[model samples]
Target: MVKGIIAYIVTDGNGQDAVKFYEDALDAQVLSLQTFGDMPENPEHPTPPEAKDRVLHAHLRVGENELMLSDTFPGSSLKLGDQVGIAVMISTPEKTKDVFGKLSIDGLVTMELQQTFWSPLYGQVQDKFGVTWQVSTLTQDE
Candidate 1:
């Protein structure tokens, strides 16, 4: 089952600044914030020292709605129009796979569904309409 969807804002490297701006402008309450530096070490891929302070993910409550923010991986950039995306929160791995498969039809798969430190099942896809979706199964911690 699908749980919910949230608007995800991607910043090139100004996530912290953006968070502050939103907090003041929208009176958003930050539910949680995690930075690249908080990720577990992996021999295959390491977080760049410069990117350590960048937000990996941040969840904020604006009024009664939710807003999420994150900084792009080091070396990546987002053109102004491409800074936003939709995140789908699923309740189960099966539902996640089903939704991911449907979203990938005639669409570009940016990241194949796979396990990561944050999610047991997660992937990114740009649908036919050019809307990006990040599908993830919710963990207890979330």
Candidate 2:
């Protein structure tokens, strides 16, 4: 049985930047940061020299949520799109607006925050790291 599900992001070489962005945008705290070089060398799982400085693992506390991420393995890449989205249910419209505004700064806003049939305030945006977010105010009936 699973205890919980933590959103994990894999970037080509932007995991560090993503962690910093989340820390600032969501006011999240970085619990742990590890680089590939921090790991012990293994014959079957060797760490590439060029990838040594990349993020091997990162753990963050986004508000009360847990988020983990890592830079892709050597010779790998990342592509973002509508495949997945991280949804945030805040306690107030103010937070929804604030988070949306911060995350949408250098990205795209597909929906403006406003009163919706299902929520008091709801919006969708793609942050600078190419991560899509759905910010909304938690409702009673949800």
Candidate 3:
């Protein structure tokens, strides 16, 4: 049985930095940050020097949601854009505007935040980190 689903992001080497960005921009609360260097040394499993500074794992709390992140493991490629999009349902229009303003500062706005038939406020943007988001404030019917 599936209990929950969490959004996990993989970055080339900027996973830690992305966590900081989300903290500042979306007020995401950082739960934990572990680096490759933090892993215990094992004779069988060796850690590479270059990966020491990369993020091993990170957790964050954004409003009522949670996100997991890590740098693409050594040798693995991290692909950005055209993959997945996060959809956020905010409480109010003001919050939607504030979030949109912050995320779109250095990002590309796919859709301007405006009143829609389904939602009072709706917008789509791809953050500077290449993460896509759909921010919306629901209407009375919702």
Candidate 4:
């Protein structure tokens, strides 16, 4: 099973702008970039052409962890608040299941575990103390 901390999501009103700022200010590298409309293989994913310029995914290396950036989908009510849940991305189905099960105990399941086009396993839950988590198992060929 694959094991590693992939990255942390940083939501921003201007994702590309924020990434650019961080790249310049912190001397960070833009390891990879993926635009919403430019997503390969899945044509029915609903990423509008207008969002082609918006960052769907981006990676900037800072120390040991990669800081991921993504623009909020147009019309999405979700916004970055004072409290943000750190996503724990696993890379295998086994790990995802294990983590999900452990977290589910005494925790509230915000989103039940399910397979997504983007990942093999994905789920969200709030632990007993109310800390939110986003867990995923890599299905991306990369």
True-structure RMSD, every candidate? 1.1, 13.2, 13.8, 3.3
**How do the candidates rank by lDDT, highest first?**
1, 3, 2, 4
Question: What's the TM-score of every candidate structure?
Answer: 0.95, 0.53, 0.54, 0.72
Q: lDDT tens string, model 2, 1-142?
A: 1124456676778778988998999899999999988887789978879888899778799888888777876886456654346767677667677778898999999788888655798787888898877677877654
Q: Which residue pairs collide in model 1, if any? A: none
Error of 4 at 98 (Å): 2.0
What lDDT, from 0 to 1, does candidate 1 have? 0.94
Task: Pick the TM-score winner.
Answer: 1
Q: lDDT of all the models against the reference?
A: 0.94, 0.77, 0.78, 0.73
Name the runs in model 2 displaced over 4 angstroms.
79-142
Clashing pairs in 2: none
Which of 1 and 4 is ahead in lDDT?
1
Top of the candidates by lDDT: 1
